[model samples]
Target: MPDLAQSTFILPQDATLTSEQSALEQRIWAFINDNHNTTSTHLLIISGDAGAGKSVVLDAAFAQLQKAARATSGELAGTDNKLLVNHNEMLKIYKEIAGTKSYFRKKDFMKPTPFINAYRKAGKRADVVLIDEGHLLLTMPDPYNKFRGHNQLADILQLARVVVLVFDFHQLVKLKSFWTPALLKRVTRDYAVTHYHLTEQMRVGDAAVNDWIDHFVRGKMLPLPHPQHFDFQVFSDGQPMYDLIQRRDAETGLSRMVATADYPFTVLGGKTWYVQAGSLRLPWDKINFTDRPWAQRPETLHEVGSIYTIQGFDLNYAGVILGPSLGYDPSKDRLTVDLAQYQDKEAFKKRPDLADTTDAKAAIIMNAINILLKRAKHGLYLYAADPALRQRLLQLAK
Candidate 1:
């Protein structure tokens, strides 16, 4: 069996914006502050690939907003000043608010309309409204009419002189209409949008890892290996990866370990140990339902085949059981792209220019693997169940 130690948590640092970015932030802030008189709506949508420091830039911008708010005494003349961060922290804040109400509970916070409206109403004097994970607003399946079309979160954007939706559309792929061509056109056409393509690699500590991710995403990516001790093995089989994860060396934290989240899904036998299902879920609830055994099963039984469960998250050492669905052809030593499995295939198809971008697909998988690999501070063990693939990995190791 493949073995990999449990991975550790990565606390992202605040990204520092350059002077040019500072100017843009200042301009956006000024527009927000001046909105009361302008009566014109302003929307600023920030898009980037995952791990491109999108959150860091937003954090910096929000920090500026806080400073400006304190300096101007929170009254931006005609602007309504507000800042909302998504991710785990936003959920926590919502939970606290839900606790005060009889009808609202911790679980109800996922439908964040009540909490959002309340926050907006209280911060009327504010001119700028920022939603870090604004994409989530679009995906929310709430029956509440307030979240509809113009009355929806877009209304809040209209209310504020300046509204910022800081997001990586890549992460929102699970949502419908996330990266649709029409939506892409709207983003490019509407508002004074600024495209900040972060070319630097900071998240991955190793240069090879960074280079590999770039190469995987956009095949043209050049390697920039670090001098650090590291090894990469490509296997024809899937079992060896599992064996590596299970390998333990007590001297180093390299000893085998297993990690679990407060969320569901158990890691067993060097692969994600979760109940099987025919399809995956959308948000948190999706995983809960899909894990039900009563759900239809595919002709073949392989656990690590789904990228939806694997992407955007990491494990200490991953024994990825490359399934046929992903078009893993060992003889060719090349991977094929399949858009059907995409979280938002319709949206992806709408962006026809990206239709042939193999880099984008590889980058997604490589990045997911990177997330899993980085979880190992010591070493990563590669394994494949197929004996030929396992032997290939062993040969690659040498």
Candidate 2:
């Protein structure tokens, strides 16, 4: 357990933007104003890596949109605008941010499914719609999510005059919501399309270490560079790392341990479950019953988080416990993934049209690792379940 108490809500970053971010927001605003009443729809795809400040830019631009929607004058005056996100945890954070602002309403933020279904039934179209974590939008009918539409993005395009989407290819983790750059291009080919690729890296502070992480995510095993502005450490054992994370949590706040879903557990098992590796043992992130995110919850210090709860969020120091599904192939002198060891079956669900599921399975697991590894803004703590993999990372750390 950590010295930090059960948590308070971590609000979105302040509404300030760098010059580059502000210029992008200005372009987005102009597009919305220009197309709000146009006969044809338009799309602006904001592409970036994780922690590239795409969400931050969107929030700033959306604040201006909301202001115009409720205003009495101006081109955007009385126009309708909505913010959409497919991730529940992220949705909670956005709505919380809305609730705190006088000009904003919680209702302005919603999931893509309900928003699409409601507006279509009401025979209404929006002036503009902004989607965060657009990579998570269902690309096919997912009846379980109450989304029976062929594709959520397509549905939104039909119901909006202008659509702005925050997308990252590396964040695609599930077969149902799988997306690729080619697929994105094909979908918006008929629309008046523009793209803004964010160049800034907002989370990790060190450039060399950031490069190492990028190579790791792409399956190119190489030496880890010595970091100047970042704290990067590798641990052969998880328990000691857990202690350091707890200490960091006490000093800095918002620090927690998160792992890939490589252990045996089910959401409906109706029993207490734990993640155990050697002498390190702890419960998985508790089923989040509060509005605060799993990492923001005070009790989460004692619980290991998963991709479901931690994606699209940031922390001061993220203690990453690499799980069993990942390993190293010393023979091939590279990293490897064992799909059988991956515990999240939902991520590997059969997609009828998906070719090369084997490759995709490995990619999804690596994607989860990428999301976990980049959560820390200042430092990162690390542990690996497989001894061979741990040894490989240790060698690279040297």
lDDT agreement with native, every candidate: 0.41, 0.85
Query: Which stretches in model 2 have alpha-carbon errors above 4 Å?
Result: 1-15
Candidate 1 stretches with Cα past 4 Å from truth are 1-37, 70-79, 84-90, 93-126, 134-156, 175-177, 187-190, 217-324, 330-333, 337-398
C-alpha RMSD for every candidate: 10.0, 2.7
TM-score of each: 0.54, 0.95
Predicted candidate 2 versus true structure: per-residue lDDT over 1-398, tens digit per residue: 32221232232244357788888999998878777788789999999888788888888889889887888887777777899999888787787777678778998999999999999999999989999999999988888889998789988999999999999989988988888777887888889998899988878888777788898877778887767778899988989999999999899888999999998777886787889765899988766766777887777899899999999888889899888888889987777888999988898888888777887788788899999998888889889899999999999888
- Candidate 1 lDDT over 222-311, as tens digits, reads 323333664444544334443454453323322222211112432223433432111221112123223211111221122332333333
**The 10-residue segment with the lowest total lDDT in model 2:** 2-11
- Measured on C-alpha atoms, candidate 1 has an lDDT of 0.41
TM-score winner: 2
Candidate 1: Cα lDDT at 181: 37
